[model samples]
Target: MNYFNYKRRLSSETRIGDIPLGGTNPIRIQSMTNTNTNDTEASAEQVIRIVEAGADYVRLTAQGVREAENLRNIKEVVRSKGYKTPLIADIHFNPRAAEAAARIVEKVRINPGNFVDRVKTFENFEYTDEEYALEIEKIRAKLIPLLNICKEHKTAIRIGVNHGSLSDRIMSRYGDTPEGMVESCMEFLRICVEEGFSDIVISMKTSNTVVMSQAVRLLVQCMDKEGLSFPLHLGVTEAGDGEDGRIKSAVGIGSLLADGLGDTIRVSLSEDPEYEIPVARKLVAYIKERENHPEIVAEAYAGYSPFDTSRRETYAVENIGGENQPTVISDRSNGNFELNSHFLPDYIYVGKELPLAAPRAIPSIIDVEGWKNGKNTYPLFTSVNYKEIKGNAATIKFLRLSYAELTEEVLSLLKEDTTIVVILTTSHVNGVGEQRAFIHTLMNNNCKTPVVFNRGYKENETEDLQIKAAADFGTLFLDGFGNGIMLQNEGSIALKSIDAYMFGILQASRVRTSKTEYISCPSCGRTLFDLQTTVALVKEATSHLKHLKIGVMGCIVNGPGEMADADYGYVGAEKGKISLYKKKNLIEKNIPSGEAVQRLVQLIKDNGDWVEPDNN
Candidate 1:
């Protein structure tokens, strides 16, 4: 709870090139170009497009000396065109490449894990002190030159830490966690400070939104306690495509930004990096606007679902447990309504349910028939005005049923007293002459009793009335948006689907291993082995083994380092064989790729002494 009240602010006086980053400046939005670095022309074209699209800063991954070689040309291309926007060189696995980029780009991103390993770059430095001092000296020998070059060129440097590429030493000590991530970054930041450079920016990105959020929270808190501060670039790394990614990014980034936390953001997507620009801009804009509103309260609760995930009705209703919903009216300019101790459902008041028009099948926003202007067809969401409703007890109806049997079954489930029901149709006859005769007839014939006890709409949404009604009628707002309701008696909403699988895999991070937990990372275009299938098979075959941690990583390059603390980890180091590790130390093994999963799983089970249950 020490961190609950901790309020560490980033240096408002910091700068990222010509764009001021901290010190009461506007929070920035950033994105990376995926164009092959080898293509200077193509990369330059994308940079110009990205600049025109409102990206504050653009990053280009410099894979090696050849890629770093394009830095000067790419800069010339942008600069010759009079584009002065800052360019960041994302240097991973090689500090020498970073050193080369330091002379050209406005910013350089270096992964500390890979940077420290190239001690040969700093072989000229000698120290008679212990290994720690020697390591620090060597680290400085390599980084100081790059820092000096950046300083001489008036460039800025940001240390970007992806949890997927964390250090082996840190992972071995703290486990792969938010705290471990913070520790790793701090070690790098300390070096940055020790070298007498405070003009620094830092980032911590994870595929898990929750961990990303929590990591920022811990970083700000821990640094505040230690009286160290830096501008933190926030992002949910590898967040997938379209609606789910957008929602998850919003919930994770929005929640923290709401608390006055981030300086810049990137929403990593699976496809076209260009798509990331608009989303990042909108995310920053939305959070900034929300900060000025007085009615929004500090989030004092948890299990916050930003979108509907429940596939069944019983699960959702059971979670509400008949809580009174605060009525949030869209009209707040005049403060016309004073909420006393009295509360109701978000929309309905007294005994009435609020009316919500359902979303109907319409033209797909992205027009899935094909891509736009000869682009591939992807799903996009059209805007809706429902966000104007500011109450928890809003009554939403899912209409335009496709099948009569499903509709009847859904109706049977909705009739329960789990929440107050309203059968009233769209009849204006209440205050005016109502004429919903056709819809009324259908409702009456479908049920022995009225589906909704009462229904009405006031100008638009009656926030006070709806909130009071939902509270009075045993209804509550759900964390997610959905067409159908869930009736569940448990807490955490279980996720399903490929998207949910990744989200759930990330969610497993919070489940503190009372024992062993299985961990795995997704393979990217660079993966040499069949990491995805191997991970699935390992998880499937060894899922019954409890109270132990097992990790299936794609390559030893970044995998062994990230999963250093796993009781056992299977890492593909070569095409035909893998290297096994028992909590940071590599165990003796040369299992062929064919039998890796079975051998790995069996070793884990035997190590943990897991016994299969007998079935009679």
Candidate 2:
């Protein structure tokens, strides 16, 4: 069997300008300069930096032909100086800018999100079906000439779709469902196809990594079904700077790429775009090694999912070979407890039906060895009183040591510089009050780089850390496993059961939902229809959005005010109608709930702009 046959296969030789995207090409890495396009020297310098750091292609915003004028000089100077990396122009709201850019750059990224139509008020939100068709035609009119110029110049186009700037009708109709996202992709693809263009790339992005992943999965699924295998560019948009962005990007992009998806990938850190290349290279290498080798995959699968069944667990590990092997480093907790890089956590799904009211606080930290393959663990950085022992041993209780005993005297004495996994277990250690006190002390201590503990969900919060953990893999976790240790100290596996009690506590708990947390009132006299049923239905319908936070409130007086943080909302209003909101600003007056979800999903799907609120 072909090694890359299990699922989606990214094109190995696809092109985006001179930058080959997939099919057989090296996975391309790209980033965009934050420098204003008009600043030619600064932008060119930054592009040079991006190239030196391994970026295959770099992009600059070309909002208009005025911007393109500066780019011509910038692109020329960069190429003349000996760098041949491709230049891509990101154009929005203006097709003229695209045409100008086609004259100088090798690629152009057209954000369907911000591009406008002939009559623009409707660009702000969803339209009636007739209105939608009319607007689509208007956009085509604006875009086709740009497409023709790109074709003539042999430049590539990227129909980059995102959440914040979609057409109004898309949001009104689809309300952010996977269906909505795919519809938006198809809508643009169909138009591009009609225009006789194929040198294209596609992407759907959101700030939420989970949602981005879901949108990608849906897009790829549809593309495969339709046999339309255009190259894909993967990204997690608006992802924060530094470590948080890296983790989120890894989860979303890495997860999809791991499953044999993604072509050219970008890890959108708020840092210098030049910093994106190394991460991109790492993701591709991991995927390539996985694709070319089999035993490595099997070995990784064995470690992450040692279960006897053939079913693929949340993560499947294969010891596939070459330099492309998955990163799995091993060290033991205090020298005796063995730890794998992929530490698997046992989980179960305990839905909203928690027979009785449960504990409010759950474990949020995990302390254990490293996580490799299917093997997973959370590290906790809290203190423990287990007896000190030599070699691998679980000291059930170790106490009677004052802070004075834990000084330099104790630090230098017990086998210095050893790895550790403090397994917090109920059977081996039990004391909530003591555990709480230890948690405070641990947090107050030196930074706990990798803290793992018993993590569970609050019936009230719906989507907390545990839910977040499960959501990272797109699965609902119900039960927690004893492998529930957090990496409180450094080293993936640290010796010494310093705080195994926390692990015991966490593994004993349960999990809830992941990402796109929803919080709504139970509803009262202000309620028009059944608020109970509405909340349930909306949750059921939009549960898969994964990256958006939605709120369903009752009553006009408080609904919008309460959900100031919601991405999309439905508030009860007078006459069995409801108000729609995006953030704190209300975008629409009142629409029937019967069609609200569908409408909102579509709006979000198009990566469209919000319709101006109807003050009346």
Cα lDDT tens digits, model 1, 293-365, are: 3231122223322222221122222212122111111111121223221211122111111112211111111
Per-residue lDDT tens digits for candidate 2, residues 1-616, read 1111223475525456566776756667888876768878888898999889988888887757898778889988898899888888877677777888887888888776456632112224646779878878877787788878878888888888765445455666886554676777787778887887888888887654545656777777787787677888887664434333454555567655655667777776645677677766765664454343322111121122211112111111121111111111212222333222123222211121221222112111123222111212223222342233233232211112322233443333222323332232111111221222222233343212111232222222211221232222221111111112322223232222212212212221112222344535433223455565676677666655655667676554335533544677777766567777787567777788787777666656655533332234
Estimated TM-score for each candidate:
0.54, 0.54
Instruction: Quote model 2's TM-score.
Output: 0.54
| Candidate lDDT (C-alpha), each | 0.52, 0.52
Superposed Cα deviation of residue 610, candidate 2 (Å): 28
What's the number of clashes in each of the models?
Answer: 48, 132
User: CA RMSD for every model?
Assistant: 16.6, 17.7
Off by more than 4 A, model 2:
1-8, 117-126, 295-332, 335-616
Candidate 1 stretches greater than 4 Å from native: 1-10, 118-133, 295-616
TM-score, cand. 1 vs. native: 0.54
